[model samples]
Target: MSSEHFDVVVVGAGLSGIGAGYHLQTLCPDRSYVILEGRAQLGGTWDLFRYPGIRSDSDMYTLGYSFKPWTQAKAIADGPAILDYVTQTARENGIDRHIRYRQHVKSAAWSTDEARWTVQAEGPDGPVSYTCSFLFMCSGYYNYAAGHTPEFAGAADFGGRIVHPQHWPSDLDYAGKRVVVIGSGATAVTLVPELAKSAAHVTMLQRSPTYVVSRPSEDRFANWLRAKLPAKAAYGITRWKNVLFSMFFFNLARRKPEKVKERLLAMVRVHLGPDYDVGTHFTPRYNPWDQRLCLVPDADLFDALKSGAAEVVTDRIAHFTPGGILLEGGRELAADVVVTATGLELQLLSDVAFEVDGVPVDLASTYNYKGMMYSGVPNLAHSFGYTNASWTLKADLTCFYVCRLLNTLQKRGLRQTTPRIGAEALKPQPFLDFTSGYVTRAMEKFPKQGHRWPWKLYQNYAQDLVTLKYGSVDIEMEFSNPVPTHAQKRATADA
Candidate 1:
């Protein structure tokens, strides 16, 4: 296969990837880049997940790109709207023209001698190859092919249709039929209320509970600001306002877990009434923010629960019976359809194999540098978002920093930049502090973090903004393999 070379090769044409393209073009205009997308279209997560009630758990203000203003009225937008926003950003900025679809990246091998990466991918016709001075991995952190679904005992006995939210069948009609959604996370919460609209009765079954919060779909402050100020100015102010509030709330939750928990449960009690079992169904065993708190726009989930359209059942599953699921407490949830809103199957760097100078690199053994680049990895960075806040916040900061790093390298005439944890005896910590099943199950396979700055992941947007956008780039990073100019090469040859 022919190998085309570019200054940068961005993996995945998702929110992060498109943002990366925009930053590269604006900040480093001289650099050439291409976005390799595995799917036929863009909008990675938004396009792939077609499940009912698919909406963003985070508000749009902070979730939106820093460069773009989210003019939509809804702060908690549905999937299609978010997809439109992402694709629109690409099209308006001409980023979509650089995208190559149906390119599934398989492996990337970096050669120190060449000071570049050789990327191998499978295309529609055959294998394709590309060489890039920098490889930006915005492919996200989950497996695209499948979501995590535990092997249910006697699953074969279930005569009804059982579907995972990741792969929802479009033609399957659940109208007026009993639907059982398994799990209490964001997906289950979202699906329960939406499915309850037409389903006979929808039940959300969970072994434990998750912290859920309610907020209005529209932001009154944002609307008022937009009516007074310019769109960009209003958006910027609103974005910062939300960011500060998120930081304050997160800090408060961490410091005063009991107080936060009490308030959260109190809110739920108001929605469900005092007669409901708040302790068993609405309360989580862990502290708030321990796992991500689910967001229900306009209290839709609560309204469904209060109206008897949907119900939450907390119990372990015994097995899948012929008609529905059998609980451990001898409770059987009879249903015509079973939807597994089970957690995602997390993967590292889009499951792409990597090697440095022909030596295989295991990411699990490396240390994460600034939550973007891994230890000992050269000319490559991954866009990983925050677990506690909006993903695009961190992703935007990462893109900005990558552009800065690339520009710095160009000015210095350097070809390779690798983070080395040399002589630093630092203890390893879990990649993420989340206790969610999806994170815990796959944490061991990902890179670890250190105890110090640059190695430690703060997960704070403000701190990341200051560090990534303005901090020193020479810390723990080894810049080598200088590219000699023609004058230097001629002088050396004469000598």
Candidate 2:
């Protein structure tokens, strides 16, 4: 079959991909594009995760796209509701038609002479190829096929069912059964309270403590604004309000770690009361924002604890016995079901091999350009969001910048644009500065960031809004008009 060609090709059909498509259509109408999704669905994370009580950690006002307003009453929406929003956005914007599901991009090769990417993918009918002027990777940062689960001793000896939240069984029954969730992150915080509703007792077994906070399920300010203002206006106002609040709190936590830690623990004490041993279970060794603080809507986790339906046990797992898990102190907790809400395995560029003129691209050796593009990579952009704020806050800005770059290229008649790192004495740092286990584990696999401007990845949205949205792309970027020679055509034909 002849290879299909387009002006642009998007790697995933998730939130970022759909937003990129919308921006491409609205900003650069002349350009043609298609979204290639590995899975046979539009919702990427929302569709893949089906564990109990899966919801967004970030508020929906900022998580929602700037172009579209999220009019839902609950800001912390469930998985199904968020999925509906994503699919609905795709349908309303006519982006769903451009999506080719189950097209897993295996590799992408960029030719300097042609100034285009030859993408190879595996589909149902077998191999397929496509050429595009630009490639946008929105595949997210984690492995879709698997999650991080540690090897526990005697895992096979357990008589009860054990499940990872990444691939939760749909048919498994847990009503009135003892459930133990093994984790302390956002996933575990969400699952414990939710599973306690039906389970006879639910226990959160964590090796260490994590910072948890509680917020209202519905945004009263946003609701009030919506009542008074127009839909778009209300959304914009609430979006900015949340953006500023997030930035302020993040800065405060960084500036005054001790004070912030005290305040956070104080809030926990208010929720769990003084009688409960908050020091043993709620106190973390690190300060606030070291890792992301888990959010429980309306103190639901605390409510569950108060009602005596759920409990937290901070101890190391010695082994899994036939009845349940045995802690290091010889204490055993009986459970009928064990849900491992561990962490995600970070995957950069969806693990798709990249080549530049037949030479394999070494991503680790390169530097991140403005947190969007990569050094020496031509006509390619990847969307990675802010660690401290809502993901879409950065995603929207990145998409806008990509659109701007594309428009400029079209106007200037440029075939390719690549970031060329200057010879400056700069120290290389990990891509993400967070102390989360997943980020720390995958540091070496990701590209390093520089200490200076443009080369540095700023987690601050305010700075990024100015740089990515309004900044010029000419600095540190090389624009060129590539023309294929007769020798190059001969070499291509021979190959």
Residue 355 in model 2: shift from native, Å? 0.5
Off by over 4 Å in 1: 482-495
Query: Which pairs of residues clash in candidate 1, taking residues 3 or more apart in a chain or in different chains?
Result: none
Q: Which 10 consecutive positions of candidate 2 have the poorest summed lDDT?
A: 421-430
- lDDT tens string, model 2, 386-440? 8888888888899999999899899998989999987786589889989999999
Using TM-score as the measure, which candidate wins? Answer: 2
Candidate 2 to truth, TM: 0.98
Model 1 scores a TM of 0.97
- For all candidates, what are the clash counts? 0, 0
Off by over 4 Å in 2: 488-495
Return the TM-score for each candidate structure.
Answer: 0.97, 0.98
